[model samples]
Each structure stands twice: as C-alpha cells, then as structure tokens.
Target: MPSITINGRPAEFEEGQSILEVALAQEQEIPHYCWHPGLSVVANCRICLAEIWAPNPRNEGKLEPMPKLMPTCQTMAQDGQVVYTDSPKAVANQRSVMELLLINHPVDCPVCDQAGECYLQDYAYRYGRASSRFEEEKIKQPKKDIGEHVLLYGDRCIMCTRCVRFTREVTGTEELMVQGRGATEEIDVFPGKGLDNELSGNVVDLCPVGALLDKDFLFAQRVWFMTKTPSIDGITASGDNISVEHNNGTVFRLKPRPNASINKWWISDEIRYGWKFIHDESRHVMPMLRSRDEWPSPKAAEAWTASMEAATKGLKSDGRLAMMVSPMLSCEDAWHLGQMALSIDPQAVIGVGPVPFNGEDKSFPGGYTVRAEKAPNARGVRRVLSALGIDVLDAVGMEKALSSNTSIDRVILTGNYPSEWVTPSFADAVGQERFLLLIDTLPNSLTSRADVFLPGATWMEKAGTFENVDGILQSFEQAIEPVDYCKSEAQIAMDLQSALSGQKPTVFNAAATRQAMASQAALDRFVSDVTLPKVPQTVESDMSIIEL
Candidate 1:
C-alpha cells in the first residue's frame, strides 16, 4: 500500500493509482475533465495538477518536506507519498489554465445547458481570478449541423474530446471527427448524413462545454431553477439509475448518476428523452369521475372515503376484485398494491398490466440499452406479485380476465405510459365490466373509461425503489411536490390497504419499509436486518469503517 498525506490529512492507496485518484478517494476537491475512470486516462486538461511535497536532499530518506507542482492525475502515488491539493502555486496554475480556456468562450452561462454542474463554472468560482484579462474579441464559430440529433457549436468547445473518443471507441459510430487545426479546429459529421448514431445525445452530455447541446433541452429552463430527483431510467432492461430534474411540474432535463454496480457512467437516450411523452399534449392531469357516480374532493381521509363509497355503492367485497399494477409504479407502491389485493379478498387476482414497446431492444454505445420492454419496473411488479403469493398476470391475461365471460367484475388498473400503452379495445373491455377503477399519472384510454379514477404522482414527485432485470434494487428520492393533486401511488395503495385490512396507513420510509417488508416474508429468502445507506447530506467522514 502507498501512503500519502493530502492537505495535512493522512491517506493510503494502491501503488499504481494516480494522485487524483487518491485525492478523490479521500473526497478532496480537484477540478477535472476528460478523466473518467472507466475510460482511458488522457489527462488532457491541466486543471487537476497538485503540488507534490517531497523531502529535502539532505534528509530525503526521512522526508524533510518541501513541495513541487505536479500533474496530480499523471503522477503515480508510491509509499509514503505526500501531496497538497491546495498550495498557492498549484492554485494559481489552475486559475491561469482556466483563464486561457475562457479567453475564447462565449459569455452564455445564463442560457447554457452546462450551468450548475459545469466544471469550468465551478473552477471559475473557486480557482479562477476575479476577472478576465483578455481584450480580444471572443471567438465565434458556426453551429455545425452534425447529425440529425447533434449540433456542434465548435466555438464552445473546451477540447475535451470525450464525444469524439466515445464515438470512435464506444459506439463505433465513427460519425464524428475533429477537423481543422488548433484555434480553427471544429467538429464535423461525415458528409451525406447527420448524427444518425444511436448513441448521439450522449455527445451532448459528454461535452464539458456547450460545444454540444441537445437542441431539445437548449434554453428550455435555467438550470438553477430545476430540482433533481434520482429515478431509474425506464427505457432500458438494465434499469439504469438516472436523475430527473424538473422546474415546477415540468420535466426539464435528465442525466446519469453513478451506480457503480449497474449503469456505471452512461444511460441511453430513451431514458434521457422519455419525459417528452410525459409532456404529451393529451397527458392526463386531473382525476376522472365515473359518469353515473358523483365524486368529492379528497384532501383528507373522510373525503376519500366519501368519494369511494359514493362511487362503488352497489359493488360488494365479494365482487371479483382485480388490481393492475403498472410496471412504471415503484416497488414499494407495487407492494402496497399487493397488500391491497390481499386485503380485498386475500384471493383476488392481481394482474400485471400492459408493457409498451415497439419491437427490438436498442443497444447504444458502451452497452445494451433501452430495451424492447418499454416499462422500467416490470421485474419489480413481478417481485411484488411473487412475494405476496399472487398470480402475476400479463397483458394477455388481463384481456382475458376483463372479458364479459370472466368472473373478474370489478377491476382496478394503473396506466401511466406516455403514449396509448393500453389498447382502446382493452379500455372498452374493462369499461363494460361491472366496475373499472383507474389509477394513472397521465390520461390514457383506460383512465377515460373507468368507473372511478385516482390521480398518480409523476416520477419527479415520488420516492420508491425499482428492481432491474438482474434483481438489483435501486432507490429513488422525491425531488418535487406531487403534480396536480395526485398523491404517490405508494400513498394511495397504503391508504386502500389500511381501508381494507383495518390497520393504520404505514407509508414507506426507506429504512422502516425494509424492516416491515422483512416481517411480511414467510421464509429466510426475504429476511434481512440490513439498514438503508446513509443519506448523502448526513454521511460523515469520521464514520469510516473500522477494521475488525
């Protein structure tokens, strides 16, 4: 093991890891670009340089402690190494490099996509000199129409080359290449085509500067105003965890979050732009009331009970009950729905609803992505169904159960697909049944046809867990308030469960819910005393693991 001192703090590391790796491992701040651990170490940006202190010549063996400026990313840490990430000289060098990069940059942080999280923006605030010294006119370049999906504003480039390298090595698209020389350098797509590659939008994210911007997200909203919520990318079978940041109730942008075990550094464009469907003009907003039934405001339990009682006056508990838990619903919500199903009869048929998809699963750069299975959490729904000992029925079964000849007369369906995921025929089929109860985040055919409709919270407003194809459970936190009077499906299902089972509503708290879930398990497979990971804000450096 190589030992190092970072800013007077003792640290230890593997022999070959760079100083940047050691510093970041210890959570020390160092600006970086073009330094993804998953990719080849280019060390292109000089921003990560640090002062490596060493011994005086006479007392070299004992480390007398004088320092020298070095590229922290390029220097390998060896035994008893010492590094200063905050030396005056090192700090000055970083500032000067930032100034040089800023010389030709356009003054557009106000509208730029790389606002809050931009390394240049962060470095400028911390390491840069107060003002720019350049008197020359800012450089300008034409927005090169790259592919259909990408527009390259080469002038905004910091020359990170992350996109170019990604195209060449990861996607093998080879549609992008650098052209011209030095100051005149520009990015150009191959002639006769735009960025037709599957992994194109990724360039927009890879660009450290606004050199590449999603034409769709450009100027949509000021970055600072948006709130970020962690959610799983619903577009893929791998179920990559993503951040869905929105302004107000409108979804503004998407980005990848680090999930070391699953989606390491990238999420596909399907996961990226799927929110567009959420903004679909006909996307339902308010709760729909059954035509023959009068619905009341449900701000509280009494109002909700009044609403339910008024809507289902003739329906009885013995009526064959069905609850369709959408794959889009979170695991905790699905579990609550499972509880609701058993609460109704303890033998009710709980069917999995429609999973929308076109055809083949699409693979993008770095790995397979955006599965043909359009739904994000089908596996999670199945997990709930299996755990609760309910029959996990699919779309085909749902259709069969809703037919006139079937015993399932009262059915509850939750549909939140961006498009018409549920068929009109299915809606008509369920509608003709004795009772159709609809729960959805957006308006769809089934919601319109149901006898009673319940509003659902969009991904931004809710917190829950999702299980990917491999059975790894990833948790998401709520970032925004519930959209338009809708409560989280978790809250709805729990309330319904409490109504059915005669127990108090037990909302899902990440830590408490796990224990509750374990208690519900009948065997060793579902038993675990494990606790939730520390919330990011509460994590403490002093709590580092103690070796046994």
Candidate 2:
C-alpha cells in the first residue's frame, strides 16, 4: 500500500484522497473551512495550506518541493509525498488566513448560540494572532429571516459558501447565493424566493460559524449544557441516526448523525421539527380507570392496582382475547407484549396496530429521503408476530377481525403515535360492549371508551430497537425520563405479566428482553443483527490548574 508523511508522521492513503482527508483520517490537525465532506470542494478556505515535497522521477526520484504552499483540501495525496503543516511557512500561512477570516467576524460569542461548538472560535484561538491588526471599522451585516426554520446572521458568516453550495447542489433550490464581492460580500436569497425547501433546516448544521441558526432552536439552550444522546428517527421508517440534544429533560434540537448508508449527513425538516409533539401538554400523564357508569374514576393507588388486576383477570386458553401491538413501539416492546398476551391465553389473537402514511416517499438530489410511512417499527412488529407463529394483520384486517370475531370479549390495544390516530370506523369496530384496555401516550376517542387506560412513554423516554424500511435493525438509548406517571410500553407489558402470575414486577431491560427473544430459533437474529449505536468516549483534561 502507498503511504504519505504528514507532519513527520507516516500514514497510508487510498488513491484520489485529498491531503486534508489523509490528515483527518490519521488524526493530524489541519485547520480548514469552506470544505465539508458532503459538499463540493471550493478550496476557498486557505487555512489548510501545507508545504509539500514529492519524489520526481525525472530527477532520478529525488524529493522536490512545490514552489508555493498548496490547499490541502484540493491537493490529492501522492505516495512518497512529504507534507508539512507545522513548518515555518505553513504556520505563517495559517495565522494569516485565520486573522483575515476573523477580521469582520463579530465579537458576539458571549451571546451566540454556536459559542461552544463554533469552528471559527476554535480555529481562531489556536491559529490566529493574539490581537487584531486592523484599525478600520469592521463590516456589519444585518440578520435575515431566510426560511421558516433557518435564520441567517450575516455578520458572523466568513463567506465559507457551505450553505450556498448546499442549496445549489444538494437541494437544487438555488435560493441562496453570494450577493456582493470582496469584503462587502454577503449571502442572500433570490429577490422573490425564500429558502423554504423541505430540507432547509440542514443549512444550520452545515454552517461552520454562527451564520445559519435554527429558528426553533435559537436562544433555547447552550450546546455545552445539553446532553447529546444517540438515537434513531422515531417518526419515520428511514431510521436516520440522530443526536438528541436536551437540557433538564427538555429536548432543544435534533442533529443528523452521519450514516453513509442511510441518511448521510442530512435530515429532513419534518424530522428536525417533529419532536415538538414529545413535550405537548395534552399528553396522557396518568393511569385512569372507568367506573361502573363509564365515567373516569378518581386517581388512587388502589384504583390503579385494581385496574391492572382486572385487565388480565379470568385467563384461559379460550381464544377470547385479542392484542393489537402498535407499530410505534420498539421491537423489544412488541415482543414483550406478544409474549405477555400469549402467556395469558395461548390462542389469543395478536395483530399489528395501524401504520400511518402521508404521501409517497420523497428523494433529494443528495440521496437523502423522507419516507411516507410515518411509523418507525411496522416491519419490526410484523417480524415479532411472525416469529411467534401468529399471522399478522394490517389495520384493515384488525378492524375486520374485531367486528367479525364474536368470541373476543377482551382486547388490549397500544397506541403511541404523535397525533390522533383513532378513526370512527376503527373505533366502532372495537365497540362499547367489550372490555378495552388501552396503553397510549395521547388522548383520542378511544380513551373515553377504554375500561382501563395506562399512560405509555414515547420513544425518547425508552431504550429499544427499531427495524427500518430496509430491514435494518438499529438500537437507541433513552434520552430522558418518562413523563410523570407514564411508563414505557415494555414496562406496562411486564407489569401486566407479573400481575397475572401473582409475582412482583421486575424492571424492564431491553437488552435482556432481546437476549430472551434471541433464545428462540426463529428470532435469533435479534442478538446477531441488531446494530447498536456507538457510544462516544470522554477524555478528561490532563492540564493542572495553577491558582494565583
């Protein structure tokens, strides 16, 4: 294999990779801007300039130095090449470039939303001069409301052109472009058009500085104070890897985690802003039971215990019970629910709940997609039912069965959808005569008819696996605690199972549940094929503080 020497360190490289790419791959520091792996290379940011020495075959393979410093982002790596990013000449270029880029940058890090994560601040501190050399007044640009989800702080932009290129090449909207030349240059939208593309929120993530900001996330919380948890896209079947940034149990934003085979480096605005429903005030937060007259009984510990006992009482293998597992639940949750139902009655009817759809799947020029199927785990729920040797039914099939099967006197239904999913026809199919036990996160028409209503948790409050549209099994960790008095669907299932057996309920562990599922011959893939999220390592600072 061919290798290149970067800053005296030898590293192997593949053909056609840039010198900057090699440096990054080898953990060598090379300050850069205007160059993103997902965007085109403009080579406008000159901070990555490096001195290069390569072998010359014409001169008997002697090493010859390039005449001037080269842009590492555009310079392809060559075998037997020697690169210097820490030499006198390269360091001087870096200082000059950093100083130039910071000339017009505002001194607003104290108030900027990107203060903690801004690349400009980091590079300026490391590669720039201690003080400014310019005496003239700095150029000031006004903030613009460019799109519904994005705001542009023109004064903070260093003209990296990352946002401009994303709109032109990836989204193909061409709404953003450079409006001026030289020091007065600024990014602006077309005269009549706005940056309202379906994926417009991605511009905020692409900006290296605080130029592009998310309107919804602006002034919400500082990046340093938030905890970022790796999670999957719970609203769509695309299963885009995401970092859920939250502070004090409140989610502030969702950023795309780069998965080349899936969502790449971008996520749709729908997924970015769809998490608002998780904190809605109308969420079901407490368990409720219906009295003899069909009115909600007062909340009490005894009432809750009685509701759980009655929900699973009078158990026999009579095939008189039906359980509708929701697609919104995790694969582990679905499996546990299925096992609990089967334990109570061997011939119980198990079917998948309703799967929601909006429009056809939409694709972007950059290969990112938004799935029409809103539910995340429909395929997973179906897989669990199939493994249990039960025939799975769709929404229509479940409705028909509920209406046709006269022996099904007890039904257990789960719904954790973000919106109202109960339709009049489906509601009528369940009817008012039978005992209906509902585990849901939101209120709907069925909540009024349910004999026992248990508040369930959302995906953010649970740790489990979801199978995407492409049959990829991905796992996510819990980002926050469940809302008050709300338990995860898996916990609810476990509690019911324990109540039926007259034993104390144990804590629900998704990993343990998956391991138990893998014990089955037909469901062994849960252990081998599920892809867990990579846990990031934390390195403590070694520098000792000197007290003055």
Candidate 3:
C-alpha cells in the first residue's frame, strides 16, 4: 500500500491504484462524468485535474511540485506523494473547463433533467470563476434525437461519452457513438439505428450534463421539490437500493444507490420508471374497512383488530391460520410479520404469494441482468416462511387454498400490487364464513371484502430491509410521514400482536428486525464485495459536486 496525502490527510492505496480510487474510498468525493466502475476508463473530460508534488529528479532528493495539472483518473498513486486538490491553480483549471463546456451550451437549466445534480451546475457555483474570458460566436448544434428513449442536445453536451460507452460496453448495443473531433464532436445513433435497449434509461443517469435526457423524466418535477427516500424496487432481483424521490407523496423518479454486491451503479429500467404506478391515483391510499365501513382512527383500528383477534384468539392448529406474504414487502417487515403470525398460531399456514417472472435473465457486456423475478423480496419472504416450518404455496396454490373451505380458519393477505393480485371470486369465495384480514399499502377490490382492513405504510414512510432477486438484503430509511391512516406494515402487524398479546406495538425498532435479517441465509449474503462507483479523476483540482 502507498500512503499518500490527499486533501491534507493520510490516504493509503494498494500499489498501482489510481488517485481517484483512493480519494473516493476515503469518502472524499470528486465529480467526473466519464468514469463508471463497470466500464473502461475514458479520461476525455479534463474536469478532474489536481496539483501534485513529487521527488525532483534534477535535484535528486527534494520534492518538486508540478506547475501544470495531471488527470487524477489516469495517475497512479505513489508513496510519500503530496497532492493538493484545493490549490488556486486546480480551481482555476476546473473553472476553465466549465467555461469551455458552457461556451456552446444553451441556457436550459429550468427545463433540463440534470439541472439540480448536474456537474456543470454544481462546479460552476463552487469552483467556477465569476466571468468567462471568451466573447466569440458560440458553436451551435441542432438538438438531435439519439435513440427511441433518449433526446440528445449536442450544444449542451460537455463531450462526456458516458452514453457512448454505455452502449459499447454495458448494453453491448453500440447504438450511440461520437462523431467528429475536438470542438465539433457530438453523440448520435448510428446511420439508421436508435437507442432502443431495455436498459437505455441508464444513459440519462450516466450523463453528467443535460446532453442525454429521458423523455419520460424530462421536466416532470423540480429536483428540489422531491424528497429522497431510501426504498426497495420489487421489479427484479438485482435487489437494487433505490432513492425514491417524491413530492406531495407522489413519486417522480427512481435511481440506483451504490450497492456493490448487487447493482453497481445502474438499476434496470424496470425499476427506474416503475414508480409511475405510485402516481396513478388509482393506488388505494388510506384504510378502507369492509364494504359500507368507514375509515378508522389509530384507536379505532386497534379496537377492530382486538375484536377480530378475539374471535380467533385460540387458533387450534398451526396450519389453520394462514398469512399471505407478498413479494414486494421488505425483509424486515416480512420477518416481524412472520414472527407475529407464528406466535399467535404456532401451526400457522404461511404462504408466499406470487413471484412474477418476466422471462429469462439476460446479460450484456456489463453485469448480467437477473430479470426472471419481478418481485424484489421473494427470496427473503420464502426463507422467512420456511424458517417458521411453513410451506410456502405458490401463487396458484395460495389462491386455491384460500378458495377452499377447510384450508384455513383465519386468513391474512398482505400485498402492495398496483392492481389486484387476488381475483374477486377467490377473495369473495374464501372468507364468506371465516374472518379475513387484508394488509396492504394500496387499496383494491380484494381489500373491500376483508373484515379487518389494516392500512400498510408505503415505501416512503417505512424503514426496513428488502432482499432483491440476488438474495442481497439491503436496508432503507424512512423518507416521509405516513399518508392518511397508514402505519408501517411492521408496526401494524406488531399492533395486531399488541392487541392479541397485550404488548406495546406503537414503538417499532427497525434495528431489531434488521439484525434478525442479517442472520438469515438470504440476508447474510449481502456481506460480499464492496466498490465505489464514482470518483474524481483529476489531479491539480479541488473541485467537487456541491452537496445540495
């Protein structure tokens, strides 16, 4: 390991490691658009320049600092090396790059998708000079449609080839490429081709500037208005940690949080745009009691559950009472729910419902896409169900058992499906004579038939762990207050337990469930490899993306 001075602090790196790697590993952030961990290093963007002082060969013994800067991404770390990123020269260089990058860029901050988090916007505020030296006819290029999913404005581009590299190296589509040289270079689709890959949405995230924009996410909402909530995406197994940014309880965009073992930096488009369902007001928000029933308060909710649990308080057989576990649920929520169910009815029939599979798990030049499973936490739910010595019936068997008369004495259905996962006939036919409980985030026709309607907290207000398709259990933090009468699924289930067993369920300790999940087989797998997806690669630079 080479111990070097970074930002006036000691930072050590393995021999031959780049300065960028060491800087980012130390939790010191540097912003650059062209360097993604999964792709080959392309140091075309000179925005990451930093100053360095090394041993002078002419003097033979003394340290000699370079007047000109070097690219931190391409420069390997050396022992006893002294680097200054916040020096005057480094800041000036960054400003110059921003000025050059902005020369031909149109003023579209109000309408561009990358406005708030864009590198240019951030660097200009922090390291950018007050005024530009250039006063010439600026180069202008017509905004072109690069692909089916992406709109390209060449004039606004900083010549960051993130889109081009993503096509060539990640999706292996090679749909986007750069044409011309120097100041005239621009990104575009090949002769007759357009970017139509399933994962094309990722390019928009890759672009540090507004050059590549998603038509779906374009001008949808201002970034400042959206509060980011750490949540899980149940679309696929690439159990990606997600930042659910929303406004007024409505989700606007989703992006991958850097989880090394699972998704590196990019989440599949399935997850990126999946939040649209949350915006479709058809989502059942607030608790809806059985038909012709009114919404209940926290106190009223407990009373109803008390009466319902009192009826079946003495569950005869373990398998007589069934709890329907939804795949979209977080692992922590599922674990606690399973514990509550088992404690009430030791012979509880635990059924894991529905693991929706799109088709095959496909791969490109980048890491393979685990696409078979649509639900994120199926693995975690199944493992938790099996841990309780219960048989997890498939979706068909679950529906069949609920439909049959002798299958269960009391049944609990937990789901967050955008639409009804269980059919009306099955829901209506199941609990005509028996008591039925529905635990859900959104309301559905199936919920209307439930005797005990417990409002489940959406992903925004819940802090729990979820295991993705890769069996990687990731934890997320709560973002906002629970909408209407909804409480976290964990707390609601705990409240039901409190009603039956007289234990206080109002205080939910997510840490306890998180620790429990950490021991399980499926969740234990998250302790694998770790990596930094983005870092500064410029030496002689003190510029960083400002924390907004």
Candidate 4:
C-alpha cells in the first residue's frame, strides 16, 4: 500500500494509482475532461493540473514543491508524496485553463441538450472567473453531421479528443479525426465516411461536454426532468447493462450503465437504439380470442375473461400438452409457465422456443461484442427445462410432434421477438391442435391462427433475472408500466395457476414471485451463492470516466 497527502488530507492508494484516482475514490472533486478509464490517457486536458511535492534535490529528508504543474491523471502517486489539488497554485492554474477553454464556447445553455449535466457548465462554475477577460471577438464554428447518430458542435468542443480516441481505440473505425490547428481546431469525419460502427452511440455517452450529441435524442428532454431506471438490454443474448431514461411514462432513450465486468464503459448501437419498439403502434395490447366460427370475438372484459377460462379448460385436461418457453422471458417467468404446464399434465412436453440468429458476432477492437444470438435468455430457458427433466425441442421438433401426435391436443406458445420468427409451416402445423394459446408482446404471423391470444409485457415492463450465454444471472427492475392494456407474464401466469387450483387469483407481486422462485430446484443454480456487481448510480457527475 502507498499513501499520499492531497490538499492537506492523507489518502491511501495502490502503488501505481494516480492522484486523480485517489481523489475520486475518496469522493474528492478534481476537475478533468480528457482522461477516461476505458481509453488511453493523452493528458491533453490541462484542467486537472496540480502542484506536486517530493524529497528535495539537496536534502533527502525535506519535501519541496515541483517547479511546474503536472497533470494529475498522468502522474503516479509515490509514497510520502504530497499533492495539492485545490491549493492556491493549483487553483490558479486550473482557472486559467478553464478560461482558455471557454473563450470560444457559446453561452447557449438554454438550447443545449446537455445543459443540465454538462461538465463544462460545472467546471466553469467551480474554476472559471465571473467574467471573461478576452476582449476580441469569439470564434464561431459551424455544426457538422459527422455520423448517422452523432452531431458535432464544433464551438462547444474544447479539443478534449475523447470522441476521436473512442472511434480509434474502442471501435477501431478511425472515422473521426482532429482537423485544423490552434483556434480553428475542430472534430470532423473523413470525407464520404461517417461513424456507422456498431458501437457509435457510445461517443455520446463518452462526451463530458455538449460537443458530441445523439441525433435521436437531440432536444428530446432535459436531463433533470427524466428518471433513470436500471435494466439490461433484451435485444441480444449478451444482456448488456443499461439505463432506461423516460419522462411521463414515455421512454426517451437508453444509455449504457457502467458495469465493469459486463459492458464496462460502452454499449453497442443495438442496445442504445433498441427501445423504439416499446412505442410501436402495432403492439398487441388487448387480449383476443377466436370464436367457434373461427372469427375474432369482440373486445370486452367478458371476452378477456372468457378467453382466460377457455385457456384454463385447455390446460386442465387429460390430453397431452406442450409448452414452448421463449428466450425473451426471464427465468422467473419461464419457471412459472413451465410449472403450470406440468400441473395440468405431468407428461406435458416443454421446450425452448425459436432463437433469432443473424450474422456472426461483430466484435470491436476494444473487446466489446454484439452477439449473433438475438435472444436474451436462451441459456436461462434451457436451464429451467433441464432442471424440470423436460426435453428441449426446436420449432421443427415441436411442430412435428404436434401434427403427428394426436394425443397432443393442447399447446402453449410464447414469443416476444423483435422480428417475425414463426414460419408459416410451423404456425399452420400448430393450428391443428385442439387448443392453441399464444402469449406474445406483439402481433405476428402466428397470432391470427391462435385460438386464444394473451397480450404479454415486454422485458422493459417486467422485473426478473436473465442468464447470459456464459450462465451469469443478473437481475433487472421494471422501467416503465406495460403499454396500453398489456399484462405482465408473471401476472398472467399467477392468475392462470390460481384458476387451475380452484382458488382466487391475485395481482402479481414481482418481489414475492422472485423470492418464491428462489426455492425452486431449477432456479437454485442461478441464485445459489451467485452475487452480481452492484449497478452504478444514475446521477450524472462532473466527469464521465473517473477511473484512471
């Protein structure tokens, strides 16, 4: 262990830790812009300048200050070394640096999207003078559309080079570069080239100031008006951690939540822009049922209740039953669905549903990847079925079994896929069953043929744990309420189970359901002594990448 004194306060740190790292760990404030934990430190942002002290050149027993100020982010802490982050000398140097950065910055916080959480605003308040001393005209640079999702406000940039470094080091696209020199310096993309990398949305999150902005969320909402709910992106099997930003029941955007073990400081464009489906107008919001005449029944509570009763009758039969567990569901929801199937018929066939696989895994230079497997919980679904001693089947296997086995009269299918996954052949084959019940979040090719359709909630509307491809189970909380009249899978499952038991069904309690699932033998592996890292706080800070 090594120790150092920062601003008259003793702080302990590791041997190779820097003064900025020690200060931030102790909740001490040290203004910075160019340094990021996930990127190489260039020390271009001189805002973190601090006075350093070491053993005197003439006398080894005495301490003396270094003649020049050093960047705290690049300077490693030594035993007995004394550093001053806010001393008179350090403050004077930082204020001068801040003044230089603001000489060209426009005073337009009212129209800026990053006004509430902008680092430049905070730093200017702390280290800048009340008024600018420069009497010359300010430089004005035109805004440029550098990428499909990124817009650059040249005047707002302080030449921190965070965005340029992100594309070069993390994405390896090299689409961004610094143009011009001195007062005319600005970030620009190569001609005929835009930042279309799979990880391009990360630059917006990496930007400490308002220079880099997301085109999708430009002027959408103020940061202070929205609340962030921690969750994981269900668009891919990676289960990358995320935060859903919404205001007044509307999701404005999705940003990566810093999880050092999983996603680290960046998230792919899929996770960043995949929340649009939540607001799609074509979502299946109301429950529907097919009458004896093969026509959809009119919408009403009676229709919904009648459909539930019909589904219960189908499940409470002596005939063979089949349940298709979707990878889009959490382990807790899948477990409940499987239990209800077996309770009706001990020999019920249970298997995983369709898994969407696109191109091969697209990996970046920084080790971030977008998996080809689009499903979020396939491994989790398999774990549940394996624990229940049920044989897993694919779409082909389930269709073949249903069509050939006359004894398989009842079937339960669920899917929340972003795209159409049910083939016409499979849907037509499953339509032959005596009772066909479909549970889904959106309408698809198979919905029209289902005897009963239950509108299920999306991953954003429910709370549960999902096991990634590597079998790491992580929990996520519900972000927003279910869209329109949709009901959660847990709630629907609970109601159906109660109806089967000849008792009253109550509303779903996610916490209680998760607690009850802890005792299940199938879920024991996921919850047994497995501890996930705590999610970082959602409050925006003066700095984005504090770890150095």
Error of 2 at 360 (Å): 0.9
Candidate order by lDDT, decreasing, is 2, 4, 3, 1
- Note the clash tally of each candidate: 4, 0, 20, 0
**Alpha-carbon TM-score of each model against the true structure:** 0.84, 0.96, 0.82, 0.93
What is the per-residue lDDT of model 4 for residues 253-312, given as tens digits with 9 covering 90 to 100? 998877777788888888788768778888777787776422243444665688799888
lDDT of 4 at 170: 89
Residue ranges of candidate 1 with Cα displaced over 4 Å:
50-70, 84-92, 130-133, 147-149, 292-307, 357-365, 424-433, 497-513, 522-534, 538-548
- Candidate 4 versus the native: TM-score? 0.93
User: Lowest-lDDT window of 10 residues in candidate 3?
Assistant: 529-538
For candidate 3, the per-residue lDDT at 146 reads 68
Count of backbone collisions within predicted model 3: 20
Clashing pairs in 4: none
lDDT of 3 by residue, 1-548 (tens): 66989779899889877888888889786656566776788787887788988777679757888777987887888887788778888877888877887787776798777887788888777767777777888888878876666788787888778888888888898888789888888787878888888788888888887888888777889786777766666556666767787788666788777666566777877778765554455555455445435644556555445534643353334447877888877766777788888878776767777777678888767874747777777877787667656667867777777777385778887887655576666566575766677877665666666767666766656776666655455666776666655677787677667777866656777776665555767454433421212332434434577899
Q: Against the true structure, whose lDDT is highest? A: 2
Candidate 3 local Cα displacement, residue 511, angstroms: 1.8
Per-residue lDDT tens digits for candidate 1, residues 268-342, read: 666777767656555544555665333344544544565455434423556687778888877777877787767
RMSD of 4: 4.3
User: Which is the winner by lDDT between candidate 3 and candidate 4?
Assistant: 4
Tell me the alpha-carbon RMSD of every candidate.
Answer: 6.0, 2.3, 5.4, 4.3
